[model samples]
Each structure stands twice: as C-alpha cells, then as structure tokens.
Target: MDFLRHVKNILHTYWIGFVCLIYQVLWRPKELKDLQQHNGCVAIVTGGDGDIGMETVRALCRHGMHVIIGVKEETNGQSVEAAIKATCPFAKLDCLPLDLASFASIQKFVQQFKAKGLPLHVLVNNAGIMHAPFAPTASSSGSLESHLGINYLGHFVLTRLLLDMLKRSGTKERCARIVNVSSAVHAISTIDSIKEIQFSKFYCPYGAYGQSKLAVTLGTYELDRRLRDAEFPITVNCLHPGLADTNLFRHLSPVLQPVKNLCAWLGFMWTPSQGARTPVFLSLSEEVEHTSGKYFDNCQAVPSSPSSYDVRLQKELWNWSCEITQLPCDIQDEINIHYT
Candidate 1:
C-alpha cells in the first residue's frame, strides 16, 4: 500500500510538471504596468531573500510602497534590502528577523513591526520548503511537522496577530491584501483528519509539502469567508507561482539537481521574475483589488482543488489552527468587537 501511494505521488508530480510545460508553451507571462503607487502603504513579504520573494519585493519597492521583508537571517534580510535600494535609491525597506519554524520568533517579528507603527497593506506569505528531510518544529504544545509548521501554521499565526492592524488600515475603497503562495501540487493533497495535519508517523517529503500547501489554500478560503461575513475590507487569496527554477529544489539529490537545472534552462520552468508576476499582479492590480478568497495562476482566477472548497474542511482546519496556536476559538468575534 505504501508503495502504491508513493507511485501515485510520483505520477502526480510528473503530471503537474507536464501541465506547467504546456502552460509555458501556450501563454506568455503577463507584465503589470502603471501600478497605483502608495507611498506610505506598508507591505510585509516573508522569505524576501529568496528568488521569487526578492523580485516581488523589488516590484513593490519600485511602486513607492514601504516593504518590510521577513527573513530567517538578519544578514539575508539586510542584503536583500540593500540590493533593492541600490536600484531604487528612494525605496522604503526594512528587514526584520523572522523564523517561521518558531512561534516565539513570529510573535517577536510582529511586535517589532507594530513598534514601527506602520499599517500593513499587503502580506505575501511566500516562504516555503519543498521535499525537505523529515524534521519537526519544537512547539510549546508539542512538535509540529516542519513543512506544516513553517509553510502554513507560522504564517497562520502571523496573519492572526496582524488581523486587527490590517482591518484598521483598510477601508471600503481599498482593502488590505493577504497573498499566500500555494502550489498546484495542493490539488493532489488530502487532509481527511487532524492526524494528517499535525503529524503523520509515515512521512513522505512531497506528501508533506503538498499537504502543507493544501492547508494554506484551505486557510485562505476560510479566513476570507470570515472577513467577508464580518464586512471587513480585507482580501485573502492564494496562488500557484508556476514551477520556477529556484533554490526550492536544493533539497533534491545532487545527481537530480543538474537535471532539474537543465530542464529549467531548456524552458521547462519559469525564471524567478516570471514566477513573481502573478503575485505582483495580485498585490497591485486594480483588476483584483476587491477580489477575495480566490485561487490564482498566471494572473487569473482559477478553480482550486475541489476539496479545497469544502466548507467543513476549511472550518476544521481553521478551528484546529486556532486550538494549536492558542488563539481564541472564535477569533472573528474578537475582531468584530475590536473594530466595533
């Protein structure tokens, strides 16, 4: 049975790769222009030192928005900030240390940002690990699987912490945005029980990564629903950044790494800048300014996996996330009262 599951997983991965190649051949990557500039608006992008995240930060900086990059290392954050400022001399940028694997670090990063008294206009949860070796985050409640912890839970806590600020910063005319960088592989993931989310005794690298991304997608939709129900002017959405040839593949075996690079060089994968396009578009495009709770690819709304839309699954994940994170079970109620 385990062998069958592994075979299925491999097939799914190859199928997605084949589909991405077709997408690259059939469509030209779109460019966004004349983005409306918000000189004082602040945006936070996690993993800003990475290929796609850095490009997203660069695009935002070019448009006059203040960008705060959340990095695991202070030096990496500073390096990215300096690189951007070199090109855009007036770019407003700050780097804060953020390690998503650690809840205390996430909370500290939020507190530090709050100290700056800046309003968050956009948040790009762009940090993720793919097919990494098995490891678990040492959490207060218990250990969390690394992929789920960093990719979904950490961002989950950070967003909840900043929800009030995003609410206050947004108005009817301009809603604050939350862009989660999910993946096409999420469609193949399943979360039928809490065990699937918290910890699985049997671990498969791609399986773990896919389940985490699926959680991200599920959380995106659930949070958007709650915000909209409360009439809050905040948009929550997630997207697939295409198969970009970024260091995300650094986990691959050394023998397979060159083959991956060769495929990328041969036009089978997107460059980091190309992967940044849809995220940048979602962040700044007037087209989706009010769009919420949708999944996107290549700058267009596309239906996500059928399971992703299951209200039961969405709420289950939301409730479980709150329980594990030690947040109030009825968080939306808290937000509503805080706004009132």
Candidate 2:
C-alpha cells in the first residue's frame, strides 16, 4: 500500500515534474559571460578527464579562473591540463593526481595545495564511478566495495583535508561553495553500516553507488549544520548531476551494459555538457549563496527524498565516515569535515 501510494504521488507530480525536468535538461543556462574576471579564484574539479569534469574546467578557464583538474592518474590528468592551455591560453589550469579510492593521494594533493599558500575559492567534488563490481583501495579498510569507498569515502576525506584552504577562501571574498556532485540514484541507496566500516561483505554495485551518493548528500546536510554553529561564512550545497554519458559508467557489469546504453540513447541519461551545468551553477551562481545545505536538480531546490533529510541518518553517516577515514572524531573534526 505504501509503495502504491508513493507511486501515485510521483504520478500526481508527473506532468509538472516532467516540465521542470525538461527545462532543466534542455535550456539550462551556462556561466559563459558571468564567469569572466574570476582572476584570483582557484577552483578544483575532480574527475577532470573526459566528461562533465572536463567541461567544468572549460567553463572555469573561459571565466579566467585558475583551475586544478583532479584525476586518478598522471597521464590521463595531465592531458586535460594540456588541452585547457591549448584552447584557453589565458586560462591558468593545473592537474592533481587524485585517486578517489585512495586517502594518501588525497592528502598528498592537499599538502601540495597548502604549500602554494593560496586560498581555494572553490572545491568541486566532481569525480565519481558507477556500477563497478567490488574493489577496495589501498587506504580503504572497508569491505570490497568500489562505489562506497571511492564515490563517497574519497571525497569525504579529501574535503576534510581541504577545509582550511576553503576557510581561507571564505574569508577573502565569496563565502566559498563546496559543490559535491551527487546523483538521483541516492534516492535508491541506503547504508548497511552507518557508523563503522564493513569489510569482505557481499556487495550490490548499483546500491553501493547510490549509498555513496546518499552519503554525499548527508555529508552536505551535516556540513550545513556544522558551519551554522561555527558561524562560518561559507556555503555548502549538493546536487544530482543527472546521468551523463561519461567514462564514469564503464564500470557497468557486462550484463547491464545494454540497459545503460539504452538510457543514454533514450535521453534519460544526459550528455556531459548537460550534466555539468548544475555544478557550474553552484560554483558561480549569485542565487546559490542564499541557499545553502540544499540539494539541487535541474538548478532548483528539491526535496532529496525523505532519507536525505533525516538528521539521525546524517549523523550516523558522518560518524561512519570519520571512523573509516580514521580522522579525529571530535566536534571540531566533525564540523570541519562536513563544511569543507
């Protein structure tokens, strides 16, 4: 009965929802003109290799912002930096080798940034992989789960590492927006262990991916609360990038490959450019500063399913993240981890 009622509610909102979805996908705006004069801003986009991340770097370069493009490997990462320099000669762009599955890489990347002594104007957690079978990383002691470890755990650690730089950015000009590129799939995800790391467990690839995204959204909510209490000047927000046709989906098991391709062909999954627009919006939009702790889809604030707003869920996820990352589980640590 409950499921039927839920389906009926979605149907009731179906037409208007479809209209909003179409407008968001079809005619969504870009920051082409407004991004200019972003001279001192240092923006970072993870997964800056082929699809949405690359497009985001393009937008930042055109706006004259210095961008740090983060990728998993030096070879694949450096290529994007070179491409940016070629097209946008005035655009200052560098590359960071970030393995979203590894903690050492994230720490090393942060150390390099701190060495520069420059304020980070923006941090975009844009890298993500989908539907991969179980695989753990060097830093992860968790069970054999790729999506949970990389998609969620990776950014949670990286964001915490970079929070000081972000605080510096907030003090300078715009209260920086830490944009976590989340997904609609989160609505389908739930954590099995919301307070501790689990290992060697049976895994569901898609469910794990969704769970990580749910963590991402929960992390954002937790961030909002922490920053508010700290009186921090920065804004933290999240969004579902919509399904984009990117290499990120190469993880689909062979059996599900056809269905994934079909979604792209049918326009259910978006193009890279389309998928990247909302991140760009959160990064540069004038209106978003006023709306924090919100998850956006199609450039508008929308409820992120009932689970996302559950404070208990957010805390449990946050605590679990801290334990997995082995970070200090202090109030300050929790606050810093969430907001940045």
Candidate 3:
C-alpha cells in the first residue's frame, strides 16, 4: 500500500476501520439529477478565493454543483470566481463576503443565504487563519490568540447559522454534509490548557494553531453526536487536507518560509491542487454517504487523534466555541458530548 494510505491504519484503532468498511459497503454518493435546477442543492465554501479552496470550487463546478465562494472581500473573490468560470463556463458560482473573524459577518452571511430560499446541501468550512500574531476578536472567547478565534470559533458560528438550511436539504439518508477542514498537525494538538480556549492571553503559535485544528476536529465529533440524538438529517465530518502550499503560512515566523520551502523542495509538501483532492473527494464521494463523525485523509475515513474523540473535550471546546461566538447552542443535558 502507498505510505500515505498506510496513514489510515495509523489513524484509526482497528475496530473503527472495520465499522467504516462495513458501513461503506452500502454507501452511495449524492444524486445529482435533482440538483440541476440549482433550487434545492447548493454548496457554500468559505475562503474559496484561492489555493485549495479554489480547487474545491473547480471540483464542484465540474460536477455541476452551484457554488458560493465565501470570502473576506467580494472584489478579490470575484476575480477567483471569474478564473473558475474561465475554464468551466457552465460553473454556477457566486462570491460572497464572509469574514469568519467577525460574529456579525458570520450571521449576516447566513441570513443572506437564507433569503435565497435555497436548501444548503454542503457547508465546507474551508476558511481559517493560521500562525498569525495573537489578537482578540469577538470569537476569541476572552482569548488573545486569533488562531482558535478564526479557525474554530468562526466556523462554529457560521455552521450554527446555517443549520436550518442544512436540515432543509432532506436527503433520504442524511440531509446535508458539514465538512470542517482540519489539519494533520492535529496529531500534535491538545486542549490541556482548557483555560487557553478562553483568556488565551498567553499564546504559543504552534499550540494555538494545533488547538484550533483540534477544536475543529473535536467539534465535528460533538456535532455528529448531536445530530444523531436529534435524529437530524445532516452528517458532520472533518478532514485534514495534508499540508498544502497555500498562502496560509505567509504570516508565520520568517524562519518558517525557509522551512516550508525546504519541505516543498523535498516533496514533503503538496501543491494546492494535490492538497485539495481529499476535501473534494470527501464532498463528492459516494463511499462516505453513510459516514459521519469521522476524520478523513486522502478521501478515505481515518481515525483522528485520541484527544479529538474525547467527548468531554468535544463538549468543552463546543461550549468554549459558543461562548466566543455568543451564539445559542441547544446541546442538552441528556446528550454526552466531549473531546476524544
């Protein structure tokens, strides 16, 4: 087997793999015949202006899915949209403003989307800020670091905002897919300093980045459980798009530039096109139709770090995330939620 594929065995305990394999035996991809009218199915992608996000746009377009590229700005996003249209002229695409760092922006975008009166089929929470300096935002949950605030908290709010739209899709098995983009570095992440999720005044760049990714992964598990209990139609899953050569690291310490360059030179890194394959495959794959609450890599289901599966931590991070977003979370006392 390819070394990259071997990573799957390393990720999941043997039992989880068996369960996934059995569930996938009857799996089916989303049917495209009905989505043609662009009435019931639409994909909303955050940070879709460039890099891996753009490649996802291309994939969705190729499959004839109407897509919305959510970005921090319209003009810049439009240029990317035009570029996408240049190749797939039939691509139904729109660019919307979405600053994940702002709670208001998150709410506003969802509200606008609802006004479109279209059922949202997939929400690819693809936007995130990485390795930036410590800064505070409404999504900070009293934390000084921007990594968790933007990467995890922002998507938290946005997903909450669109939950209704996701439910309305009403596919027979699952209504919609909420795919949160996480990272491979999650193997090194932990939420031990639970205090840091809030009042993160003391910051370590790597820790904060890892924590943010961990939070996204953990959130997927919690959301998956919640959906199951509520018997909701949506399926929640998260995946790591193996280190892509996107602009995500421009703000990292200058030394990282050389490190990134060296990694790419040595083939340890992937170009945005290569990195996008998993997310695109996850979004388009029929094999995963029955899969939920799992972390994936290279288009296949894999086990995330043990910390990511802890229900307690998942709950903690979910609460901390909601606190930061100041959004209402309907999690109940009866449900068991935690971080792995």
Highest lDDT: which candidate?
1
TM-score of 3: 0.82
Backbone clash count, each prediction separately: 0, 1, 17
lDDT per residue for candidate 3 within 1-340, as digits (tens), equals 3343334423432243234334333442222332223333589999998698998888788887889889898898989988998998888888878887777777778768878776788889898877566677653444446777788878887787778777778576645888899986666565564674542234555556766888889889999998888877888889977666789878766854796687567555667877777777667666677688988876768788888878888888777666555555674322122211
Ranking by TM-score: 1, 2, 3
RMSD of each: 3.0, 5.3, 8.7
lDDT (C-alpha, whole model) for all candidates = 0.87, 0.74, 0.72
lDDT tens readout by residue for model 2, 57-91: 88877877788888788898778877777888787
What residue runs in model 3 are displaced by over 4 Å at the alpha carbon? 1-40, 138-144, 198-201, 331-340
TM values, all candidates? 0.95, 0.84, 0.82
Candidate structures ordered by lDDT, highest first: 1, 2, 3
Q: Identify the runs in model 2 with alpha carbons over 4 angstroms from their true place.
A: 1-36, 142-144, 191-201, 253-268, 330-340
lDDT of 1 by residue, 246-295 (tens): 98989887987887888888887889999999999999888998999999
Worst 10 residues of 1 by lDDT: 331-340
